[model samples]
Target: MVTTSIPTTTKSWTVLGTDGFDSLKFSKDTPLPAVSDYEVLVKFHAASLNYRDLIIPKGQYPFAQKPGIVPGSDGAGEVVAVGNKVTLFKPGAKVVTLFNQGHLGGSLNPQTSATGLGGVIDGTLRQYGTFNENGLVDMPASLNWQEASTLSCAALTAWNALYGLNKLQPGQTVLTQGTGGVSIFAAQFAIAAGATVISTTSSAEKGELLKKLGVDHVINYNETPDWGAKAKELTPKGEGVDHIVEVGGPTTMEQSLNAIKIDGTITIIGFLGGVQGEKQPGFLDALVRMCTVRGVLVGNRVQFEEMNRAIEANKIKPVVDPKVFSLEDAKSAYQYMWDRKHFGKLTIKIE
Candidate 1:
């Protein structure tokens, strides 16, 4: 790999405090960190927003750093420089770093040192950021910078949960809750895997759109509050769904149990439906019935590469309803996502 000198300073957006945190403050004169032997510097072009980014400002994510940290985890860009030991990618390659900085090769462990970009470390919300080269994956030839940016967190997590852990198969029934980034990707990936997909949406319009995407069934949770019964009704013998990509924590856990098949797998990854709530009924029984519940953080570099390979082979397109906001419109973008007004992935173009 080729190496280059890190500039003395770089432009970035830094959070100041948690109190009434609104917009990302720009700092054009911020100094860039010198690249280490295992790291590389990337010139970020685009970054996508996830629900976690919204909760970070509210102090809901305990693992995140203090208020004054950059708050983004999904991004894609060109590698401008590399460290001495970097061998996977060279400078000038289009690449995206894995969201979980420490969990490369699908190993789940805390960082040995302080090296997480964006939250625990300076993130890619700035014009440039440094990351260990092991965290970077080559962007698929079919994807643009914006599309590639959406993969790091949401898409990869869904891919790992459904395909990696669950091994979702063709003709199996799969359930996805809500229309957030991970849920949306779960819906698309299940359909691409030839599984019959059932998705839930609060809005009728979004339900219609999901139906058009070859979704076998869509439960309008707002219309039918007891949507789990409806999910059972849609499947054979009312036997319940084979796999559930669960994002709703306590709010929908009971219903998810009711909607799942005997020995089904439930992958819990987000709390978009509601964060903290009382334990749902039948949760233990659901496990007793041989149902599996697994919590998924975002995936690692190996899974990211596998997901990209699937995307390339299947020509799967991400459902991106990006609200084009300038870097200055970062606050507005966050607010839009906070209000849950966007239909698909939310994004900000760094220019």
Candidate 2:
């Protein structure tokens, strides 16, 4: 029932190659693709940055195909066009899409086609993008584009790892690493679930911030090189933590394993520390001793909806960093994230 004015064409930022993102290129000549019966066209208002965007230039991911691919997976916007059969969202509604197009409900299927925005397909960094209605969720009344953008990838991934896979309990202890998007959301989600959360950071200042967010313990990894042992010591059982939201990959994998309870769950999500680094000793034995290790891909649309419900019900807010950039400064945002100086989610505001 919501009807709105239609625009002829939109301007968008395009990632040509390793040279980095080119700003606000006019796309007046690029004709809008006709919406498929199940698809809707979105006019993006804001988008958030993730580490995945940083790897496209280096060719670290094989799926990142040719040049001219727009690179951003998380964003929120208003619906400007809807195909005949699109019933979930109508034109003029505010909505956000899942990071993964085809993979829904933890099941992989070719029906939806696992094409990722900004990688296999053009992404939302542009002013206009099209997606299947099934992949889109209505933005909550309380969230703006920036806040809704943060929910697509990082928040959903943490939700699935802690609640979906681990089913973390109210009194369970959770271990998280660093202050990056995923780790910070892990901390927030665990706290909201009434779980005891312990986080590690290289900066004491960020650790203090985490403590204020209801983190039960914050370990300064710089001062305590064996922070995993410290995490074990803090648990009520004095054994180890119940779950670990692992993001540091091999560099922190051994330590994460060491910090977990005998039958604890460790959800491996990213390689922020180093992709190919060596893991600590006793990893195999640790796994044999009843530990659960899982590699998490950012979740699907159903999980995104579930996470959004929790966000609305519990009144949880994402800890977004203060740095805001225009669409033109997206490259600078990438550089800042690469430097690892950001305390929380880094974002770009587009109108």
Report, for every candidate in turn, its global Cα lDDT versus the true structure. Answer: 0.80, 0.80
Q: Give all TM-scores, in the order shown.
A: 0.93, 0.92
**Model 1 Cα shift for residue 261 (angstroms):** 0.7
lDDT digits (tens) for residues 1-351 of candidate 1: 465655677767777766434546777778887787888889888888888777777666656475577768888898888878888778889998677677776456666223445668666677788888877889988988888888888998898779767699998999998788888888888888889888998888898988887888888998898898899899988888989988988888878887888889988888776766676655566666578888877777788888999999989887778566666677788888888888778877876
lDDT of 2 at 319: 81
Candidate 1, which ten residues in sequence have the lowest lDDT sum? Answer: 109-118
Off by over 4 Å in 1: 1-6, 64-67, 111-116
Instruction: Give the clashing residue pairs of candidate 1, or none.
Output: 15-68, 118-122, 118-123
lDDT tens readout by residue for model 2, 318-344: 888888877767778878888877878
Q: Show pairs that collide, candidate 2.
A: none
Model 2 segments more than 4 A misplaced? 1-3, 19-30, 62-67, 109-113, 278-283
